[model samples]
Target: MSSVETVKNSPWQQGARDALPLLGGYIPVAISFGLIAVQSGFSALETVLISALIYAGASQFLFIAMVASGAPLWLVLVMTLLINARHLVYGPNIAPYLSNSRWWPVLMHGLTDQIFALAHTRLPQLEEKDRMGWYISAALIAWLSWIVGTAVGAVAGAEITSRWPLLGEVMPFALPALFLVLLAPRFTSVQWTLTMLVSIVAALVLKLMGMTNSAIPLAALCGVSLFYLLQAKLKAEGEIHG
Candidate 1:
């Protein structure tokens, strides 16, 4: 009915237009992270090595900050692992779609918010091979750009630090903003709106009750199960009305 809808329906289009956002979304965060990594008193090579290997951006930022703050190594690990536990869920969820691709595990190691959300929404229209190819291309390009961003930041971070007292300090909050952006559009439904409200309530209750460690997992469980039950019940009622 519209030009945008027409493009979305085209079979020949590769859907790479959406990929442009990832560069801007990732550059500042990655550069800030690289600068922080270097400034945490780690050698430049050390920062380069770890950022390349441990591309889990959030965990890397947390680890360096905790070390800088003199927090225990074990405490940092536990917190990082907890924060990154969502990746564990993502692994199994995407496994079915990627199971037949060559070296899917390697491709999966590059999965991030942009790649995962884009692929989930865009890939079903394309063939399996193309789906895998599109996702890998998007994710890998984003990763390479991140490394370049970090390099630039490492070189410029000192200037920023002198001016802003650690502009890189804001790097840790970027992933949460990324998460919110990815999921924000999906909140258009009433059920999803309620689920988010419930999850927030549950999280606050758990924190106030001193079950802080359990807050995230419990909130996730309550939200997902409630949404699933509501959907099922609504479907059954629709069937009866029909």
Candidate 2:
């Protein structure tokens, strides 16, 4: 192979290293999804299909739960889409690295919070192409694992959950917990920290007011936009002081 080809194909250990902790977190959550699907009236085939195809845990949960509760099809569709609205922010944030990759579609579809956090944290100084490869490999593995694990859980779900009552609750907490862990290093930046706090508080406030997932998109926009303006004000003040 040409040196250029070799260089392009060289493996990034950082991606796999970063993905390990994430792999630990997603295992049970995937299992939980499988169990939930079965209990909620989905067959094993259906569970695997949703996990592999829909591929968004929270949205799938909300979608199936709403449908099982006799929610209108339109409402379920809106909720599913709205719950996943956060993806809009994720794409452009990583676009520079991925747009030039050999596998843009794989990166876009496979990338998840675990892989995103891992790559973003480590790739500040790496070339875009290297970062893209690192992130895509890890994210794709994670996505495939989730589907595979869900399929396993679907097969043994009744036995598994019966022995572990907490499975239902613990599995769902995985993603949120993983996010908190990922956010730890970013606390050094006051502006970003404040922005995250504002977004969280806004989401919770909206939830308290009985806003469904549909309204969360707007709440997040308002909160993040407000933080951006506030940060600008602070930067202007700092410049004047300087």
Candidate 3:
């Protein structure tokens, strides 16, 4: 390939480019989040700050909903933390790939679901020296997109939505659509399939029982526990047969 193509395909460029798909999803969802948050009675500044500080996608919406319902601050905090508990698993799983980089701690702040997903698939393909730069490039782009999108929605979301009601209806689906895209490829194994099924059932049960706040974290915990048990059982069976 030509030098131009090589330059275009550099790890940093590739990282930024790879994040483009996530950007497509994040921007609209973030915009929707901003509009919803503002409509829910948050000021523009408050909405932007939430996006900047918390940076949790669906959890931010949940936070707004809980607060609007007059739920206590402590409950909001607990629920938000529970919803984002999966980050604990994400960090450890991604740590090995980033061991050589001193900046991983700072970079860890950018570890959202999409970034983690991208890192898992893309980091292994990059050279060691290139991984940090690649991650930084991708994470930074995604972060900026979210922040910018939020600003746009906060500043003009009311006007925009008034003129285009369909956008208001459709934008909320962007986040879930993005998640489904990320998850679809992982359904290749029975372990993953079973784990997800269990998680879904746990969530549905919790939701039905009026325990929606605990559903996400509890379901995640159930899924992770089941996956480990399956792995252990498989290992034991192999040993016994051997």
Using lDDT as the measure, the top candidate is 3
Worst 10 residues of 2 by lDDT: 1-10
Clashing pairs in 3: none
Name the lDDT value of residue 26 in candidate 1: 77
lDDT of 3 by residue, 1-242 (tens): 11112234778888888777776678777888888988899998999989888898878999999999899999999989887876888888877777555678888888998898778767766677788888989999988888888988888876776887776576556556656665666677998999988987898899999886577779888999999999999999999999
TM-score, one value per model: 0.69, 0.75, 0.75
Q: lDDT of each model, Cα atoms only?
A: 0.70, 0.71, 0.81
Q: lDDT of candidate 2 vs native?
A: 0.71
Could you tell me the lDDT of residue 149 within candidate 3? 84
Residue-level lDDT for 43 in candidate 2: 91
Query: lDDT tens string, model 2, 144-219?
Result: 7788779878888668768876855665566676667666766667777777777777877888888755455666
TM-score of 3: 0.75
Candidate 1, residue 203: the lDDT equals: 79
